[model samples]
Target: MTGQFQKSSMYMEHNPGIVENGDFRKNLDDDGRPKRTGTWMTASAHIITAVIGSGVLSLAWAIAQLGWVAGPAVLMAFSFITYFTSTLLADCYRSPDPVHGKRNYTYMDVVRANLGGRKVQLCGLAQYGNLIGVTIGYTITASISMVAVKRSNCFHKHGHHVKCRTSNNPFMIIFACIQILLSQIPNFHKLSWLSIIAAVMSFAYSSIGLGLSVAKVIAGPHARTTLTGGTVGIDVSASDKVWKTFQAIGDIAFAYAYSTVLVEIQDTLKSPPAENKAMKRATSIGIATTTVFYVLCGCVGYAAFGNDAPGNFLTGFGFYEPFWLVDLANICIAIHLIGAYQVFCQPIFGFVESQCAKRWPESKFINSEHAVNLPFHGAYCFNSFRLVWRTAYVVMTAILAMLFPFFNDFLGLLGAASFWPLTVYFPIEMYIARTKMPRFSFTWTWMKILSWACLVISLVSAAAAIQGLATDVKKYKPFQTEQ
Candidate 1:
């Protein structure tokens, strides 16, 4: 948020044109429900919901894989990278001053406008993958969080380790059913309340997690000595150090991977304080907010559990002690993921529906700015549309959740494959192309160098994640590690 990143906003003065003439008109959807209502508050809320979902659960586990040093260091590093790239994305929301001014509404639109060629098609693929991955990831997380709470409650109530009979797949599917109903909301802006509530929930769970970790670690006899001792918990005996390192990188990347929907988020802003400025402020606030919670969650949770930390921090708090807090935290997590699932899915739904509209405009979709009415092509068109695609996405992900409930591994794969291209590579390349800073020039050179580094990191991370999956397939055995 310093140096060249700080561009003077057009509304430096108290210009009524900028404030009064805000997104009131520019933001209306085809159905006239007023699409853009994002202020700094709502925008930051969306960002928090997008960036902080379930990823915080793995911060401790990731720290264990990377150890104290590399883990927190990499976390902070991703924070800076996310902020920078988000700003680059914010800057790209609108065209150059002279050209007809309009926001890029979609991620692919930005790429198509700036990079051109097959880049647009490529971006579309990456974006959809990232979006779908996140939706599935959230569902998986919600199920785990809910089940953990149930098990912990059973244990605490009976003063025994009660093996809760609640199944994981059913819970995931249940949440997906909820998502199918909630995700019917047409525009991203409409969910501002949902995102805000989710953000508050995120902070609640994360803070509770941090509180429980501190209490646990401090309650132990050798509390002060348990702090970061350079090589204290460094697992040199780990079977796959090289792969684990990259897996840790992918985990960090996933924790910070919210770039894919940034444009759609930018579109939600009502364009008063200027979308770029508002976006930058919102990004900074959101990242800063999440970073505080992330650092605390990662640091304290790792300190409390060390090498044995569960992938989900709340799950590690145990069934006996702090049972109430743990239950509350997990409940918050489950509720929060519901909203996050919807937030991420809006972009995917839009992409699919818009494409369908272009292909079959006569299908009675978006006939008005406010709503869409698909004809019952065979006496049940709406039901057919709902079942065929949206429901399938939830079911497909729920089935995957049944198979691979591991949060960190899922994060590794998603971050490496999807965020690699969609989040890291595209933003850097787009910025370089948009700025036209002469390929070999000093500024451009460094940007290119960073882009290459990010690319290599992404590829290595993906390979490590794939390797981990190959090894785990036989051993995982469907939700067996709850112990």
Candidate 2:
């Protein structure tokens, strides 16, 4: 190929649907992109996955430590902050001539553009580390979900129950490896229908779980507890200052998680008008739906568990009349988690592809067209990539999951730490520094306050979460049940 043809071919291979002029035009325009219609629902599902994660399972414990009133109150506060930050970041994407495409800047791009070149690279490194951590966490969760389901089935089939083990079951290990490798395929967008099904399953599972817990609590008679000797329990009484602060941090960071996808969602919209409206509509719908669900889960779970509530709400069932119902419920939860993993893992693949393309020009696998032919060129080439990447994902996830089996708590902390900088602080800072704004613009004021607030809260929550994790880590012994 001539030098010009080679360059053009490389561009075509990497850019896919985009033309040389930067507009999206290609033979297969819709092949590998998120759909625009029903995007509101998709957005809602994204918000739920971002917010819910493994956190939902352990929220009751976190709330109990803080107190019942404190827990839901914090959740609502976090919800509001998240909404505010998401809106501000979305507006940043609307600015003309953004660093990346107008609506496709990743978290790293936002930081690089605002914080100068060195900080951009630093932030990218931090984000890359974070993404690795996140990928591992999600993978571990997926594996655990599978294990939980299988164990439940075993109990159903045989009267004898076995303790959960995470050994080298060669068959399962191979199956998981295959699933991870297949998930890395470039054409996962072909499985977009899975996203829809995942979304529905998540909402349904949340609804049923919350409803059953509430009904069980209400139908059962209240039991009284006697005060223990000598030891005074930590204050259950609510403190507004602590409650509001924690709540604000949680809500803001929760919304901040969606920052990664905000620009992608905007790009997927049909036109500028549609994009703008969709941003506003999606933000509104996402916030409203999540707020309702969070409140319901928090309130219903607290009521059901009362003072005797287990640290994690999801695990503590008084006892269901039919044993099969509990098994079915566990299956629903496992399926919901599969959906959650799909949402979380998609971005990891995107990140890996972007990095591979940037770093390995000669590999040609970095180029889109070249990637399709990778499997055939050399057996070792394709297998090597698969083994290296998938192993990296699995190993990372196992380490993190083992280290912090307090999955839900770690998620909350992770949300607070990363979401604020990536979504709230960086975006608004970029908008102000990169684009001209009026001295007294309400938008500027709103974004500034939101960003600063998120920063402070994220710092505090991250510290607390890390401290909590360390404590739990010291107590955890392998082969013992996870707390």
**Candidate 1 clashing pairs, residues 3+ apart or interchain:** 30-369, 31-369, 31-370, 376-381
User: Which 10 consecutive residues of model 2 have the lowest summed lDDT?
Assistant: 223-232
lDDT of 2: 0.54
- Write one digit per residue (lDDT tens) for candidate 1, span 1-483: 111221011111112233334454454433233446789889899999999987787787777767667778888998988888788878877765312355576989888877889989989888887777777778877888888888887888776645656677768778978877776554586789899899989989888878877888888743222233223335444456566667777777777778888998888876557778888999999999888888888877778777666767675544256688888989999989999988888898767765655565444332212222435522211223433567677778777766767654655676687766776678788777777778689988887787777888888988998888777776776646463
Give the residue spans of candidate 2 off by over 4 A: 1-38, 66-69, 94-105, 111-116, 146-175, 185-191, 223-256, 316-321, 368-396, 399-413, 438-447, 481-483
lDDT of each: 0.73, 0.54
lDDT of 1 at 129: 75
Which digits, one per residue and each the tens of the lDDT, describe model 2 over residues 1-483?
Answer: 111212223334465544534334432223233334445555555556555654455454344444545566667776776676666566655445432244443555545445577767655654555555555556555555455555545545663344434332332354355456546543333334555565566576567667766777778764222222011234333443344345434533453366655554444444434455556677878677767766676556656655455543433433333345554555565555555554555556566655676677556434523222333433111323434665576555655665555564566566666766676666666667766777558978877777787678777777656665667678766655521
Q: Quote model 1's TM-score.
A: 0.84
Q: How far is candidate 1 from the true structure (C-alpha RMSD, Å)?
A: 8.9
